[model samples]
Target chain A: NAGVTQTPKFRILKIGQSMTLQCTQDMNHNYMYWYRQDPGMGLKLIYYSVGAGITDKGEVPNGYNVSRSTTEDFPLRLELAAPSQTSVYFCASSYEDRGLGGYTFGSGTRLTVV
Target chain B: AQSVTQLDSQVPVFEEAPVELRCNYSSSVSVYLFWYVQYPNQGLQLLLKYLSGSTLVKGINGFEAEFNKSQTSFHLRKPSVHISDTAEYFCAVSDAGGGSYIPTFGRGTSLIVHP
Candidate 1:
């Protein structure tokens, strides 16, 4: 099913620079999420979408934005990159809520902000 | 709001020895708990999860977890460890509310299996 896929396996951005992390899933999941992983920290959700055109902020939503235009695509936008934002990003999708099943995660995008 | 805590930051064990990673959570509403493993340079993968039905849930890689509602804990355990089992393990919780599906993850516990 190809599960979940993310583009730009790695990236480096300068202060104030902006970029978008692309994510797509072929499982036709109704839920999609963006998370960041720091050196010693666990994955923190940045944003999520319950369905196309419906999005919401997550625990660590500051400094980031997201849009879900289609059921298969959910992109995360970093408006002004900062060194603190440097981390590995993972995208995931699930068929239903957490009760239904576990999420399928993408390989991940490693980003470094200089 | 829901939150998770992984008691250990790092656990070192010899190969073929038993291991356990402790986890605790706090939430006012019902929650679904999960454990995910991340290998070096790899994405996080689901190790096990506890929803309803059973307090004991078995997951991939010969790992299992017991959900203790009284203690608000979901600890992952393996009968025997291997070098391949070396990875960072994260405990997570998600609200069971119909509208919220985002999960809250613990800081993470690094499991180092030494030969």
Candidate 2:
């Protein structure tokens, strides 16, 4: 079963270019999240959506946007990419549970800005 | 906002040896703690988590962690480790009673299991 799927596994964009990192999950999970992982910065939340038609900015949401118009898709958009935004982006989904928050993550999309 | 801190940046251990990776968080309210392991070029996988009851929680791959409320710590311990365990381990925390369930992750601890 394809739990979570992310597209454009690797991409190199010129400065000021914009693109969208697509993410879709077949588990029908209510919670979806986008996180960026840098070398030493660990995983920082970029955006999150609890359900369709709801989204919120996270710790490092600058220069990024997200929309959850449907339950299966939550695509992250990078507007005006910059060198500082070069990092691996991960998409995850989880069932609503207060105890033990285990997320089903997709293989991340590696993006680099030149 | 909650902050998680992994005491050690790296822990080098020989195969078949016991290992412990410490994790601590600073939060004013109740929080849920978790440990995740990330292999090379792979997404992080849940190693274990601490919810409410049972101070000691066991997880997959023979790993266990204890939630110490007074100390605000949830350190992961393994009685023995294998070479396959060489990866980066992360500690995360989320509010237990808050509305937003966003998690804050630590800097991560690299566990180098030498054969």
Candidate 3:
């Protein structure tokens, strides 16, 4: 399996711009998540999906949205980007609740909001 | 709600020296804990996990962690370090009590191994 794949390893967006960070997993996981990592802040969850068509907000969901249309893909959308959104974004997937097993993470996209 | 704390932000050690990365967590319900390693410019990889079995969990790259329920801590350790071991480590926790089962992650600890 290729595990999880994320596109556009790096990008710079102007204020008010919008974009989507794509994440795809080959493991057929039932759970997928989007998280942003800031310097010294660790990771803050933006959104997550338990399965296709089910999505929920996380700790820092503002300015972000997500959709899980298929078991293989979970994409995160950022609208009206701000400088505060500059961080490294990681996509992860798991077979079930994290209590069962840990998540598989993508290489991450480094976003710079100017 | 569950939360995790990584006691150290950075740890510098010489090659072949023993090292430990401390992590603590808080949760009212029973939790599953994990330690992950992230190399520079790479994604995180599981080092080990502690669910319901023994308190001691062994993981990849000759790393291990001990889960202490009383102290609510799961600290990663390696008897000897190598230059290749220089990377960032993260601790996370998830509980069954919540339907979301979303994990709480701690700020990463950077391990710097010198030659």
Inter-residue clash pairs, candidate 3: none
Candidate 3 C-alpha error for residue B18, in Å: 0.2
Ten contiguous residues with the weakest lDDT in model 2 chain A: A96-105
Q: Write the per-residue lDDT of candidate 2 for residues A1-114, one digit (tens) a residue.
A: 898999999999999999999999999998999999998889988999989999998888999999999999999999999999999999999988442569988889999999
- lDDT against the true structure, per candidate, is 0.91, 0.91, 0.92
Report backbone clashes per prediction: 0, 0, 0
Q: Estimate each model's TM-score.
A: 0.94, 0.96, 0.97
> Per-residue CA lDDT of candidate 1, range B12-98, in tens?
999999999999998756788999998988778888888888999999999999999889999999999999999999999988776
Alpha-carbon shift of residue A7 in model 3 (angstroms): 0.7
lDDT of 1: 0.91
Can you tell me which runs of candidate 1 are displaced by over 4 Å? B97-99
Clashing pairs in 1: none
Query: DockQ of each candidate's interface versus the true one?
Result: 0.65, 0.63, 0.78
Query: Tens-digit lDDT track for model 1 on A46-97?
Result: 8888899999888899999999989999999999999999999999998986
* Docking class of predicted structure 3: medium
